[model samples]
Target chain A: MMRNMQRPMDAMGRDELRLWIQQLQFTMRDLALYLDTHPEDANAHRCYLDALQRWKQALAAYKERFGIQFQEQVCDHTDWSAWVSTPWPWEKGEN
Target chain B: MWQYQKALQYPVKIKQPNAKLAKMVITQLGGPDGELGASMRYLNQRYTMPLRELSGLLTDIGTEELSHMEIVSALVYQLTKGLTPEQLEAQGFAPYFVDHTTGIYPVAASGVPFSAEVFQSTGDAIADLHEDLGAEQKARKTYDNILRLADDPDVRDVIRFLRAREIVHYQRFGEGMRLLQDKLAASSPWPKNPYAFNPSFDHECWKHKGRKEK
Candidate 1:
């Protein structure tokens, strides 16, 4: 089962990727919504900071388990090809 | 400081998948105006942004696109499961099976793997913002197409959610773009960042000490 897991940036076997993404997604969503209503909420602002930190941690874990990767290149040249050199998104063990 | 609500983080709880719908969504996955490109464009473009709110918007929205990719994959996985060869040939999924074998891939709906040329970071604020606007519209249209093409109620529900999110993202980016355009006339207080995501001026508390550029 572990052998089958091969996708990068998604962190195989942890199942943390999906849940973490969902959590952060929800965090930002609610933050956006509430901040809309209560722009002055100091607590919400602090939460945003914490949420962003959590988000970075999730990104780090994903990068650590899989490798640093990007969805697209800003530089026209793939001169920084190393970023895209890893496995593709559909490879097994990546879910 | 961005406080978060746990419930809204990953509100999509189901793991439903539909093949035809998946195919259309893949257009946004690997297609020119797809989610992958949008995500990449915004995430990478943030470094050069002059505003805090706009940068935050890009980071959050770009990150959400990653989930959109996963949602499509989940749908594809559910749709392609337990298929027979005959079904494969009839449904036009055979060629893909040969390449990926029921796997979720970052390919165009036509079956090509993702390409790096999908997104751009020109470093010019007006150009990138225009691109962001167009990108959101393209994604919205793709979702609209998915809504038209998908027959399954399950798939339609998710498509509706996805479609709505695109509109929201468009509004967010549009607002951020306007904010930048207005700020351009003033002296560059936060550096001439074309990718800054904050449309709101509340970055004083949310920004990190080390990460703050100015």
Candidate 2:
């Protein structure tokens, strides 16, 4: 009998990892906007920090496993042109 | 300074080309309450915003509107990706096709080009925030109208997402208004008409020190 268990991030496919990173990023952005207005809300601040940390970790994992998605992560000065040469997010369904 | 991130905020993989739907959806690109106008309004208003928080709010939301503008353009591009001259002419898209030929030009359904006259930047936080709140609703209503005419599930999914964002923006602007009111009520040298004094210009009204206004 096989059970449908959730796979860990390291074992996840590229698409799954991308989706996870996107979710965490969006959570952080939404909470950032909320905290901008309601600065005194401690609960929201905590939630934002948690989301931000997760986003950073997931983004790092994606960078290490796959190619760099964000340009800020690209630290190698010799291969600076790769950032421009790589397929953009809008260029969907391309090789 | 803004950086160009080459991606849609949400993916719009349009599988079908429907010219009729494209005309209606183009309104959100350049209509009176369109994304272009929305972005310009908030970004321009922020310079005179009384509080740093409110300025940041305008900046972030305005930036998001620029992203929405790209989304609208993507929708228009995908919906009119390929078609014969006859098909375009028959589907009430001849006028637009003659002018732009599938190029994403910001224009309303009525074919009027985008103009700066659509939005206002009053420099008064109260007035500007109210306008923003109203603008969000107008954009949401336009999306609702598009949803009524749209048949494709893919198109509806993207439109639904955009509409939800309008509601979220409206909520934030409302909170901004409440913050302004509370600050006004608690501050010194209070005007007979609290709404009369422009918080952006009047230094006294901006006196919320030590993290507490009261």
Candidate 3:
């Protein structure tokens, strides 16, 4: 039940939303590694699926509000400048 | 086949520029037990793995190592950013500054460039898995050493994350080794001697016997 609780994404700021998306991404990545070795683990598989779904939603929200994080997401928008103008991950106060 | 992701796997926003710390952390990027070597080792070795699961594990872990490489590069970049030449000289970063000028070049803190000699891709599954296990411990130990010398909380926080990943990878590789052994044990004529032959190279013999059994 606790796992099912959703964060209020609409009320969150840009940085907060980005951090939430990162947490979800980390969950998905760790779960994927576990599932790779324990292919038959139903619970882990379930968690992976949930994380993936949340990650997609969070990423979409982030992209629509901020900008695309990957080249593949470029097709969703016409302005390529938004992709280039944003600060890179290594830059201070960017990521 | 890998696509570029504009964001880092983890965030790195080091406030203070410490050239000295950057020198030490650069080792994780290009040192003997660095993430670059770790990625190359697993990716290359995956080709010769006897089992699908082992190959998949290698691919996933190897991909993660690439992200780790980026994280290290970002750490080094932030650590060395915006330092004056005099400040760099005083911090013992002059040698690296002369060559790279704050550019993220893959070289050990000792100035040795990265080399393929850091890892091996033996066609033998047992040997390769052992190499991976050893590699993970070595990387973890290097992170421990960095943690010992590094004083900045910001740098250490990222280092700790990278160090923890090595432990997880070690566990996965251990599982992968066990999976390989079980498969080899079942397929071997001498069930007690799984090491009797290289499953990667002797696939024809295994296939013929497997076909006969069917």
Top candidate by TM-score? 3
Model 1 C-alpha lDDT per residue in residues B1-214, reported as the tens digit of each score:
3332222222333344345555666676677777787788888887766566666777777777876776666556656666676776677777777877776678888777788787788655566778888888888887887777777776677678778877877777777766665555233344455235332333432233334344
What would the per-residue lDDT of candidate 2 be over residues B1-214, giving only the tens digit for each residue? 9876444577777888889889999999998989999999999999998788899889989988988898888888878877788988888899999989988899998999999999999878888998999999999999998888898998999899999999998998888888877777666356345677788787777564333432
Predicted candidate 3 versus true structure: per-residue lDDT over A1-95, tens digit per residue: 31656667887788888877777777777777777789999999888888888778777787787767645457635656777777787888777
Runs in model 1 deviating more than 4 A are: A1-27, A33-95, B1-18, B188-214
Q: Roughly what TM-score does model 3 have, to 2 decimal places?
A: 0.93
Which whole-number lDDT from 0 to 100 does residue B109 have in model 2? Answer: 89
Residue B27's C-alpha lDDT in candidate 1?
72
Of 2 and 3, the candidate ahead on lDDT is: 3
Docking class of 1: incorrect
Using TM-score as the measure, name the better of candidate 1 and candidate 3: 3
lDDT of 1 by residue, A1-95 (tens): 21233244344444556456545646666477445434578988888777777666666675556544433221444524645564443333332
Error of 1 at B126 (Å): 1.9
lDDT for each residue of candidate 3 in B1-214, tens digit (9 for 90 to 100): 8876677788888989999999999999999999999999999999988888888899999999999999999999988888899999999999988988999989987999999999999898889999999999999999999999999999999999999999999999999888777666666765667676788897732543442222
Ranking by lDDT: 3, 2, 1
lDDT of 2 at A71: 66
Q: How many angstroms is residue A93 displaced in model 2 relative to the true structure, after the best TM-score fit?
A: 4.9
**Total clashes for model 2:** 0
Residue A48 lDDT in candidate 2: 79
| Residue B31 shift from truth in candidate 1, angstroms | 1.8
